[model samples]
Target chain A: MTTTSASNAGFAHGRALRPSSKVLPEHARGHNRSLVLQTLYRSGRRSRADIARETGLTRVTVSALVADLIADGLVVELGQREETRPGKPATLLDLDRSAFVIVGLDLSEHSTFSGALLDLDGTISARAEVALAGSTGEAAVEKVVALAQQLVDQATVPILGIGVGSPGVVDLGGVVLSAPNLGWNGMPLQSILNARFGVPVLVANDANAAVLAEHSFGGADSDAMLIKIGHGVGAGLLLGGTPLFGSRFAAGEIGHVVVGTDGGAVCACGKRGCLETWLSIPNLIERLEEEGDAARTAVLREAGERLGIALAPVVGALDLSEVILAGPTELLDGPLAAATVETLRNRTMAEFHGSVTLRMTTLGQDIVLRGAAVMVLSGQLGVS
Target chain B: MTTTSASNAGFAHGRALRPSSKVLPEHARGHNRSLVLQTLYRSGRRSRADIARETGLTRVTVSALVADLIADGLVVELGQREETRPGKPATLLDLDRSAFVIVGLDLSEHSTFSGALLDLDGTISARAEVALAGSTGEAAVEKVVALAQQLVDQATVPILGIGVGSPGVVDLGGVVLSAPNLGWNGMPLQSILNARFGVPVLVANDANAAVLAEHSFGGADSDAMLIKIGHGVGAGLLLGGTPLFGSRFAAGEIGHVVVGTDGGAVCACGKRGCLETWLSIPNLIERLEEEGDAARTAVLREAGERLGIALAPVVGALDLSEVILAGPTELLDGPLAAATVETLRNRTMAEFHGSVTLRMTTLGQDIVLRGAAVMVLSGQLGVS
Candidate 1:
């Protein structure tokens, strides 16, 4: 299928990319500083005058913020802009991409927890992993902390912060509400990591983190969902460049949502015909194995159709423009993805939602880790 | 059902109601003014110092903004406060609730196009309606204009603006993308009304308009959906106090989404087993009449289950806290609403989304009209 993965294209009509909000004077300085940094981060090297012009801030304000950023070592003076009909070549400034590394941990894997040292731009510089070995509760938490510490130690540059993408419903305060596999419920993971590492620690659902990675790094639309079909079927969502955290911080937790009227297999959540039962890796594998290669395409198509049934209301309700499937390419790319697109078209108002792009994500197994980096970048520096 | 319809409660966790955004100095004055107005609008009467304290704005800034508002006749000094503390009693200020009236038009009804003159508080001061009289195309457009003119004439106060809740896919630019029922395809409704009335005109889909009214006046959670099941079914969404207009301004166009795997009735949109076929007023009434009272509960329950099947993914995906049904309470309340709640609980992860409130709107038939007023208030004055 020809996928229309235009970056931030869905937000082009009504809302702007990061629309400015009304601010009090108390917040203006910090907001403007982030705006200047964001301008530089997104637009590459730009002079103080250019930053002021783009952000609608006065030159004086931009200069002061730039000076502070430079002093903080978060920004660096890049020689000068190439002269093009200017009175004088203005000195350029940009993010100091090499000055700091972020430690990111992905706790969504079934057998092992992975960690990475990622640069400011989400590039993985170093990697580490520790097998779960049937670890649960405090033991699993310890392994995560050890992995983060190892990644932190491997970083040649100063560590900016640590971001963890754990499985389950993670609240705004980074409390793991529930992660059955990890034997966690209401665990204060963010505070624990912050106390241990003494840096800004951000923890979110792995799917939530992955969506951010897709939003910030991958060429996904601003109004998009990144469905992560791994051990369990979950999704991450970004609406107008902001992550949506629902009432219970259970936003994007679509794994257990029953898909079709005709119920089938039972889910681990004790629900019959949950999307996870049809789409989760183990469930799909077992079903395919049971049916053999003769039913391979049929099995994949059926699973894909079920996913579409689960997603149709989401697409129709939210008017989401892009859906990026993050999982095994061999399973999600061809027949399954095609069937999903067909199902969506058949279900939604054709004229309005007919063109919703459904595609497999370019980021593979490291999506959650890289998304963890994005979480840190957004939390600490206010830039992603 | 015991409903948890706390006003704006869902937004209390992560995002604040109207969170401050980064702004340049040029935009700060207007933003602060809106903040002050919004504070008084939500909190009744308050002194300038109180507004400043509540908004984190400087006392001097608040004083200036309040003065400007008073000069504009949008706000009024409501005398001195009844002393509850030591020192001189501060002067209280508030929005002039009757200073200006808004003209609201609801073009969703099949037989009549209705209009109302509403006060700043969304109270309908006067109402008018023009029968369709078999009008379509240009004739229908003319009737809408006539009804608006009648309402505008009835307004004893200066008109703030004209807001229309039309039935169709209305874009951000106020153009009706397609309202097939009214033979409107890409009609420039807002512009036409603006050119005639010489006031700010805002047009939106009827359901979209209704949701805004619920969000602003009906004590709805900030993250909620208002399902309008009239001649056809549609939905209006508010996420964090902002209306969601999808990629094609059809974010809440859920009427046509095929609900179940087992197809049944064919819809006007040429879809099988669409949510509208099960949930629309015409469809429900027809089914109930055909099967008589014996099958009334069963038919309603089945329709409600289908509605839940359509909504479970949406609830799980967005983590929405409330779903308000806006239509005939006789048809939607009791069994249908209860079945929807039950289906939602059964389909979704019960622990996380068990409390998603499904309730009928108290606004009754005036919902779209009052919602139009909200559109006017939000568009012209930045407060809803």
Candidate 2:
């Protein structure tokens, strides 16, 4: 195995350059400690009292946890607050940005491998990508490992853990049950990566990871659905700021739901009338190619309408505030976006009226990778 | 208002008869307290130490909470375990079954009104049914209230709260957004009941409630989907032991999902090709009535097949453990059930390979009522 000098530097810097603090045990104490850290990380600078009030933890407990965090160099006390609230000024606490680095990996059919080095606050410090010669599981894994190593080598902070987002069903144990595009099944991805990198690894479905990224970085308030209209159609549901993973981890598999049960084109998954059969990038591209410019645009617009109809139940049930679209702008923008809005407005309860907003992802192609980094942060910090 | 002495007696007796030396809170507390109570309720009698270990709460905190509970006569300390495992004999604790009673009400078009009175542990102690005279919103609500009052009066325990499950989109505040059968739209149910009866009221979509009831009472060990096939086709999703409410509180509106884009019957909701349009009881009956006995059976079987096709994506994505059919047994049992199983097996991933079981609801006609009762229990005890 090649020695990852950058990984060592990141770890050393994370530990030495910042502060030497013992990691808390993952019990009740750890839960509170992580909550404090997360609050500071999310809110930028929150006083110990503010965290205590927000989290419902006692002020004494927050003080103790904050003291421990400060002693460990994971948090820093920034003197006193500038704003006054009719009382003594409170001491604002902020996360030590250089305390840890999270490595994120995104594996998609279009993009073989993309990796990012994120800090404690989820700011990407470094990134790298590798093209795959062939779109196969083995080839993809190999490229991912290499790209991960390169990204790790470039990191200047201490490495905390790694998170990977791949398509298909990912179990709690980080096993990839299946990825149709990669031709993978029952892949022991977590074990392999943990053994290789000597770090904790979390493997999540790409859509779920994307939602996490959006929830944390995109500033979604409460409930939202991140629809990924790429090679396939899938959704990541964020209900009350937490990603919802259904019993079989298929909560958001809207792609396979039959949109046109009879006489629709057969999907790659061998199903007729599947939403993905009509909405997937390849399928849409084929239709566009066959239908010409005006027809293609019309078809894309119609695809969005069908997608809206499909998602009406989701919106109605969850009472979400937004639907974040993550895909190529050429497909998701313009008429497609307008049609989606129209259908959603028509199908949903009028009380929701204009509550749900449909917007394109700001992170662009880097969304999956950023989401993976967010996943790592969430895992390490115990946010979810 | 006519005073219902029997209902008052039920509530008074249920609360006053509880053992005074119990160690669980009388009513729901904050998140942590509720988590502990839920753990005990689900797992059964366990020591405070064991509960702390299972729930990741501090022993001291658990002890304090338990003390508060015991004082309130909600939880009781059982005699010490006869067999000790190389440690101190732990005193087991359990929920006081007589502390509170939950009333569940189910109102559907075909089924006018049904209900059950459930104890703290979710054991149904009393049940009642009343015919619905009209399908309008006000008429249905009046019938439901009368039936609920009847069940409440017959109850031999103190009532804590009431839960109502109807076929519609319900909000957190117990308002029904729309129910085509009942002709309800934006009905303020919670406020209406709260005004009449000084107790908490929970309103949920029938399918959502069914999923919860199935998870807790239907012997479902993993994530499962409970499809309620009565006058309409609705689905309830239990994901990770919790009901998976989508973004808009309309997560399980599988009925409105278009199964056929063209040449399908128009739904009462003004949509075409809805699953309910093709597979609902009225539709099935109409097809059977027109086609004769042979075609009727064939249509039922075909309906099951179509359902399987519609549900294939959910199975593939969620890796669902089972699909429970609840409704008229005459339609869902035998050939229809068999056809559903066959289609599901064929369409899903081979590796899942007979993993998803197709079963019928054991509760029969009371499934919806019991589900509604479960919803009340969940809300009263803060489990959902």
Candidate 3:
């Protein structure tokens, strides 16, 4: 039931989902390798026969794939299984969870760039950060690289790869298509980091990365959207466990979508009543402070309602039942979450989408960092 | 290329796109079969070697699959390839487009249940309609069954299958979850039709069916949303050529989503300012009548803007570049389409989403019927 299991991996599903497409001999081989790794990753441990039976692969095929994985240092053989009535105790196989560490960077924070060294299971072992201090463009990029270097240096084991969660529309090739606050446009962040660290690098929108962390670790549904409300608002969409990379690689860029007809505040994108005006952290906090304690509930409710207005169509259009909110828990949990649920039920078909759930993310502030690790796991080792 | 080709088929992609899933020997056989068929379908005619080279299948494998297809009467050899070459001319192969006919029913029309007998290429060879002056419940159900029977009888060739495009939330099992206008609730339309006709039957939401037609025959982009505005407003989504069936099989049910913050007309769904209030044909015509000719342009523009407001988030969320409008091209093409484009550009990230195209569907009123045929093609023959 793990989200990152081969049954739910996002990297190859969306584009490669076409059944009419040919599955070459090489594709079958790669698919089988991933299948074996994911089976062990999901079950924690299994014998060759158990994996063969579960995946419908032959015993010989499983044994061969297992040997290859062990040679690559990706899997290790534990002691024989403890059984009372078996003819012979079979050897158990599992992922070498501690063999290598992954470097993850979160560059979407308002004033700092943060990085972490994480194990295969996404457990953070080390952390580092560098102050951004009003930096933009090249300066901000330098801060992110320095933080990643600091975390990479702290890794005690061989580094698997590096992953980054940045604020912008990132292309599939890991180019920062645009990030207004960080002053990047068409920056090849992944290539830059890969050259510097000489390891695989993967970069994605912060929200997109956060959704992966939620899927891999926080138990989010296969069909869900994670809305990350920070200095700016954006969403990450996972449909049937596949992240949607839109035609322009801007699939989850919903911050500038105008929400209400009765315009209120102008947005940075030059649109009035954009969802960011109502839901971004700074705007929500500013409105709450202006209204005082008596109207705190009202302000939060209004903001939540606006978010619901923006999300109701998405829910109906995607048939999504779960929406995870990654942001300040103190501001988004109670009144805001409740009002979003209420508004969604009122706007969408009750029998179909009435059960749509809105809740704060359990991953907290480390979600993007962990998700970055997942990207590296998926890209470098075919495991997430 | 042909949208229904194996390279773009949607049937198993979204659910079976997991690379970690095992591609059993049986799957490879089926995949290669589909590849050969889609290659010929896309090229109109191709030699076995041409298909082998294009699909990367061994020539022997393609020859074996071609033999099976010919035996099944799904393909026909059309003489040898015509060219001035030194070697022997290869035999040309193509789909047996007219060997079997599909019975397709469009039950979403306001006053009529339309049906058609279509070729494998989606060309209608015969048509029939049953007027529904004011039928609902059992009477409407009978009307649909009768219409399908009529079209099946009209087929000149052996019936390949039957497909129905009904107005409602249709489950994957083809049950009409709810279509209040026709008084259908939990009616197993597909099974009932199959029982009556002794042929495979597939049913989907009318808009969902129409979107398939747009993708298969109308040259729609892989990532597109077709908005069908008729008796009630709804949408059909295609991401990377795969139709999105949400968790509850209610994806693309956008009519009920509330749009403007300032409430206006109350909808049949008991919600004010739902997208239906602003976009549904009857509502728009009524509003236009109330405003008279002097304000027709203004009324349509406002409705278009409201529609844009409803769609901006969808475009941003899915990164859709093309939106095809069905139903009353006169109303949706000129002023409405222009305003929708303008609003979309204003509400979304300008640089990324500015090129999003809003256009009228070219398939006109027959879209759902054609889409129904496509459903049968994909379900019964692994083609579309």
Candidate 4:
């Protein structure tokens, strides 16, 4: 049961849950390799026979793939298992976590640049961060590079790839199309980092990164949505194992959607009554301080309702059952999330539908960086 | 050049278009059948070598598969193709439109149950309809059955399957979980239709069917979305070729998302300022009649803005570049669509990203029935 749950969790983390043969029939060798790697990474050490049985791969295929992975320094053979059910004790295999480390950058934070060295399991090996001091453009880019370099220097094994989660509309090429907060416009962050470190680098939107982290490392379900409500608001979507990269790679930009049409406060994007004006942490805090306590309570509740109004259609359209809010838990988890759940239930087919779960993100602030790790793992090593 | 254009169209229609070697790996035989059939269906008649070349399937494999298809009556051999090349003229093949006809039902439109016999290439052979004169429940269901039977009997070729596009929340099992318009709740439409007709049956939401039609037969882009603005307001989402069938089968239920905060019209669902109140055609028509000619245009514009306001986040969240409106082209294509496009540009990343296209559906009122055909083609025949 433990192994089964772990596999399920790992399935959401990376790759499809169904057997490769049943789900997709075109991929041959690459599919086999990913299945083997993901199995070892998620379910812990297992003998070749166990991996084969779990994945529905032939034992011969698993053994050969495992041997190749070991030779490629991705997997390693361990000592015999101590389980008492077998006639002969079999040697176990596991992902070689120490064989490579990934550099993960969280650039979506409000006032700081943070980077971490993450192992195969998405655990932080070391961390380096710096508060921004009036930097923009190349100056800010230099600061981010310095942070990544610090983490890169701390790597205790072969460097896999670097993954950065930044606040912007990132293209498939990892170009920062826009991030007003970070003062980046068309910055080729992936290429910059790749050239600076002479290694593969992947850059994604911070919310996309957080959702990826939630999906690949934090056991988020398929069709789950993670909304990061901090200084800004955005969302990351996972429909099954695939991240919904919209036509323009702008999926999950929920902040600027005009809501609460009574024309409340305006947003940075020059829109009135946007979810940004209602849901951002700054706006929430301002309402809390400027208005009375009743207003404070009311603002959070109203903001949650507005969010629910925006999401009700999405949930109705996508049949998404799980929604996770990533921000200050104190701010989002109380009346805000409760009101969101209430509004969503009232607006959608709640009676006829399955229960929709709304909860705070378990990973807290480390979500973006770990998501960066997930991107690197999946992009470079074929496993998350 | 014709062959090339056809390949491009078919490429947009089916198979994993990304180098075929990655993403989806396990749909081997299914993939090949679709590739070959789509090429023949869209590109018109072509020699076996041309299909093999376009699909990247080996000539021997294409020959063998085409031979099986011809035997199965899905393909037919035409006379030899004339060519100026030095080699002997090759035999051309085409999809046998008369070999097997699909029965497609459109239950989305108001006051009628319409069905059609569709060819393999999605061309309508014949149509049948029964007006619902204030009938509902069993009476309405009986009329729908009669319409389906008329079309089923009109299908001169071997019947492929029956596909119904109903206005409701359809489950994976083809049960109509809810359809207030038709007075259906938890109706086992698929099973009932299958038992009655003795053929495979598929029941999908009308919007879902329309989007599937747009994706499979209408030359839609990968991240295309089709919004059906009939008596009801809903959306059909296609991320690449995958339909977004949300967790509760409520994906595309956009009508009830509360839009206006200034207490306007109350929805039947007991929500104020719902997209339903603002966007439904009846509501729009009422506003036009209540206000004057200026108000007629203004209401449509405002409705479009409201629709855009709801979809800005979806476009932002899903990065959908192309959105099609399925309704009266005269109404949706003019000021309404323009206003929606304008509002979306005003709210989303307009300057920093690629342009978003908003246009009326090319399929007109027949989109849903054709979409039903797409469901059957993909489900029973595996060749959408």
Candidate 5:
């Protein structure tokens, strides 16, 4: 079912890989500088002229900013490159990897933590995971702190800040409003982590973090929706390269959107006819166990169709170019995926008829961890 | 629910007025200057520092821009103001009413009309409208051309640009992909109007125009969803003070979102369970007429609840602070509006709780036309 060839390539071609420079506000010069640093980090070492050309900033501005960055020890000049066609060779610049490291943590229902040692350019130098079975909030906190300490101890770089992506609604102040998966509510996550680690800690919704990660690194450019059809059918929206938190930070709760709206299976969120009731892996497994493979296949197909219909309005309203599926390959790569693509094609406005694509995550299970890392980087850098 | 107070004083309180400076892209300094000029035109005379403070630009930048504007004969110094302090009174600036005019056209299913006059800040100095019934595309074009000529002939000011807002999927190039209501498909509206009007012409979706108007002039001050609950449930999204046009031009088709999957009223778009099928005025009227007034009231209430639920995901996703309802107030003001508010409050996450407010359109019938004018200004001045 890997039908992504020229169509995906063309879609990629049509999209601008870098955020448009025209949209950057002048007052956000610092933000633009961070963006340039991020781009360099993502693309490895590049010359000052190359960075300026890529960022759409004047060479003079880039030079000044680079000089400041070097003076601040955030970035370093990597000597001069070999002359290609000119007399003088240009000096290369790179993020000072040893200057600072960001710690990323992901907390879920079953898993207590996953930590990554991210460098100045958001590169993960090391990673570790820990289990948290039957752990209370305090215990979980302690465990996470210990795990972070271990990760930091392993890292040869200086720690800058920490970012935590947990399954729940997180406020701007890093308070977890509710994490039903973890049976948490009103948890002062940032305060606890900050007190323990003696550093700034940022907490964000896992789905939002994942969306940011996908937008920043996963290559789903343009306004894209990342549907995580795993234990639940949560969605992450990247609207114009930004995660939409909505009025309540509940914007990506596509799982609760009633697909059937009548007598449908009840969802864990105490809702009926939720998309997740039919889309989740356990639900699919239960249905398959009860009704055999054929029925299960049929149900999955229908699930895909319903999901497509459910998302039709969002697509129509947002004119998104891509919908990235991140979950079990067995589900997303089969008839369910095909049905989703078919429904999207048929239901969307004719103008976007063949333009939108449904693609699977290339990062697979690592997406959550990477997304959590991205959350930390973005938070520390003030990108989001 | 007439709840006006000193807090609701127009333009004085930040919340009661659109933040004029928030949407201006940093690069569009000239556009920002023009916006200030337009604001002064609409609001009559305003002091220089007031304009700067209102526009969120640095006072120095505003002064420089205003100075240039005055030199260009686009603005005039309108006498000095009495200082609250014992210092010299500051000189006030106002839009030169005789400088330039803009033409705003509204093309709906029932009407093809033109509005012309000076938009001194956005205030209409003189206005005219023309009706086009039983007119073919060519005939409509000719009529519009004649109407524009008539307006120009009667005008005492130079014209800047012409803006037309129609119910269709319009591309940036002004090509109308389809207007099922107006029987327009793939029409090169911009080129046609440009050829006839001899001025820059902008063609955009009516909903997009409405959002632009709300963002520029209406009381919208934050991330908002302007739902045009007229004949259809079209929506315009304002994210971070910018109109969010999705990948294709199909964003804001909230009408097509399925509210029910099993069985519901059939929509004009050849779909079932569409939000429009239940919430639109015509749909409500039909249901009310068929089901009696009591049943209609109940239905309207239920419809509002459904709309709230339908928008819950969006509200949760974008964390929008306001939902602006634009259409007939008679239908939306009572139980329907209450239901919408209730659903949004109950369905959204707790943090978003008490954060969103649903309000009626302030512009009434002139909304679409004003929106069209805004669309033109935004396009002509390159302000997204």
Candidate 6:
């Protein structure tokens, strides 16, 4: 399926991205600083004067912030600009990609714990993975730490921070409240990583991470939602550019919502007729194995319809425009994708709305790692 | 029914209230100005230095902003505050509640077109209502204009703006895309009122307006959903203190979401399983009239459970903590409320998050009008 993932702020219609007249003076300078850095990050190399003119900041303020960035090893003085439409040739400043590396971990992979060392621009510099062997508790934690350490050791530059995307609900403080697959309950992942490496750490739900990755790198419309249907089903909702952490940080747990209603198959959550039971890859594959090729498409289409049923109210309530799915594209595309779009259109109020665009993930398997990198970038540099 | 309506930003957990470090230099000063005004609006009265301390603004900046407010007639200098700390007594500044009057219209009231003139603090200064007699087309539009003009004529203070909360799917630009009840289709409400009154005007769906009113006047949690179940069923979603007016401005059209699986009554939209078909007050009342007291409770409870099923994924997706039902307490409380809560618990990811608190609106019947008042305030002055 053709995917349309623009910036998260696109679907928000200038709500989240628009700066209002309700900020304080204390935050003004910081906001300007972040703005300057964001422009530079998004636009690649730009001179101080160019940034000043673009951001409408005084040359002096931009120069001062640039100085601070360079002093902090974030920006580097590059060669002179082309000197077009200026009195003098201005020296361009660039994000020093080699100065810092971020360690990102994706624990959502069913049988493996994957890690990657990413540069400032989210380029994967090094990679590592550990076969999980279906371990939980201390063993799972140990495997995660080992994978992180391997990526950390492989880093060729200063480690900016470490971000882990685990399966389950996570609190604002990066505490893993629960991960059924990992057998994790109230795991202090951030503290553990922070203490182990003596670096800043952020741990978030894998689905939330995937959404962040989509927003930062995958071109998600600002107020869009990302649903990841692998071994487990969960959603990542981005309102404006920021993720909706919900009141309890369990905002994106859509897998266990009852979809079958009349109780078909029992789910791992001890519930009959859950969304996960209908849509999970393992369950679908199992169902497909018993059916013919023609029946496979029908089964996947039914699963897609079920998924759409579970999400229709959400789309109706939130008016989220873009619904992106991430998983094995083969099973998610064709008849399944068509059925999902049909169901969504059938469910939402199409009189006022056109139709919600359905797309497949562009980042694919590396979505979580890139999302974790984005988490580190937002937490450490205040930029996404 | 117990009601809990805290300040709108309370449930947002400082997300919308906290000034982010991503604003532009052009918006910084305006932001600070809004911040100072918002503080005064929320905290009642405070001195310049006190505002500085609360807002982290310099004394000179606060004094300058306050002076501007006073000049604009949006604020007034009150008597000196008592010297609690060791310093000279400071004159306090307060929002001039009588400086501006907002005309608010509520079209959701069954068989009536109600209008009110409200002061800056949302106090109803004058009220007007016309029994609709189930009118539509040009007649309905004429009635709305007459009611608005009556409120405008009664305004004693300077009129700030007019806001209309009509029952429909309104686009972000204040166009009534569709209002089945009022026989409206693509009505340019904001433009019509603006041209007539020669002042600012905001037009929104009644449910959206109700949510906005809840957020601005009734102290709704920033991350909350308000379900307005009267003659029709609809919802208003507040994400990060702003109304979620989906990409096509159809964010809260929840009533039409398919709810009944076995295909019962057909909806007004030609759907057989819409939530509105099962849960609209008129339908519930008719069903109650046929049943005994025990059966009445069961019917309401079943309706509530169906509503909850339609909303569970939304609650799970948004992780919203506050769910407020706007309608008669007689039909919504007791068994209905309990069933809704129970269904939400059974459907949401309770393994990680706690139960979402469901409550009746504290603003009662005036929610849409109050919401219209809030729309005018936010549009004119960017407050709340």
Q: Give each model a TM-score.
A: 0.93, 0.80, 0.96, 0.90, 0.82, 0.90
Interface RMSD of each: 5.7, 13.1, 2.0, 6.5, 9.3, 5.1
Question: Candidate 4 chain B, which ten residues in sequence have the lowest lDDT sum?
Answer: B1-10
Please rank every candidate by DockQ, starting with the best: 3, 1, 6, 4, 5, 2
- Looking at model 3, the pairs that clash are A17-B13, A20-B6
Docking quality (DockQ) for each candidate = 0.47, 0.25, 0.69, 0.38, 0.29, 0.45
Candidate 5, A370: how far from true, in Å?
A: 1.3
lDDT (Cα, 0-100) at B187 in candidate 1: 94
Our model 1 lands, by Cα RMSD against the true structure, at 6.2
Quick one: RMSD of model 3? 3.5
lDDT score, residue B29, model 1? 67
Writing each residue's lDDT as its tens digit, candidate 2 over B299-377 gives: 8887887777566655654557788998888988987888988877765545443567899977667666667766665
lDDT tens per residue, model 6, B1-384:
001111222112223332233455545566677678778888978989888888877899888888888888888999998887897898988999888898999988779999899888888878999889888877888888888888888877788888889887887667788888888898887777777777777788899889887887777898889999998898998876767777777788898898735666888888777888778899888888878777987898889889888988888888888899999988898888889989888876666434678988999889999998887776666576
The residue-by-residue lDDT of candidate 5 on A1-384, one tens digit each, is 011111111111112111211222643454556656665666758998998777776788788878877876778888999987967899888877678777888774355577788765456788888888767667777777887888878876566677777776766567787776666788888777777767666677777677667776778884788888776777788765556665555667666655645557877767566677778888877877888876877988988987886776677678788888888897778889889988876665555644778988877766766676666555444332
lDDT tens digits, residue span A1-384, model 2:
111211211111111111011111333465566667767776778887798878777899889888887877778877899875687888888988887788988886575577888776667788788887665777667777888899778877677788888888777667788786777788878777877887777788899888888877887654778889888888887654556666566667677765534447877768566678778998889889989986867998988887775666555444566888999998889888888878776655454434678999888887887788776665665442
Q: Which order, best to worst by lDDT?
A: 3, 1, 6, 4, 2, 5
Q: Kindly report which residue stretches of model 1 are placed more than 4 angstroms away from their true locations once superposed.
A: A1-22, A80-88, B1-22, B82-89
Any idea what lDDT model 4 has?
A: 0.78
Docking class of 1: acceptable
DockQ-based CAPRI category assigned to the predicted complex of candidate 6: acceptable
Best by lDDT: 3
lDDT of 1 at A147: 91
lDDT of 1 by residue, A1-384 (tens): 001111211112123211123464645665566778788888978999998888777898889999999988989998977888858889998899989898999999899999999999899889999999999999999998899888878879888888889999988778899999999999999888888877778888999889988888888887899999999988888886777888888999999998897878877888889998989999999999999999999999999999888899999988889999998999999989999989988899898899898988888888999998887776666677
The ten-residue window of minimal lDDT in model 5 chain A covers A1-10
Q: What TM-score describes the B chain of model 1?
A: 0.92
- Chain A TM-score for each of the predictions: 0.92, 0.84, 0.95, 0.90, 0.84, 0.92
What is chain B's TM-score across the candidates, in the order shown?
0.92, 0.82, 0.95, 0.89, 0.80, 0.91
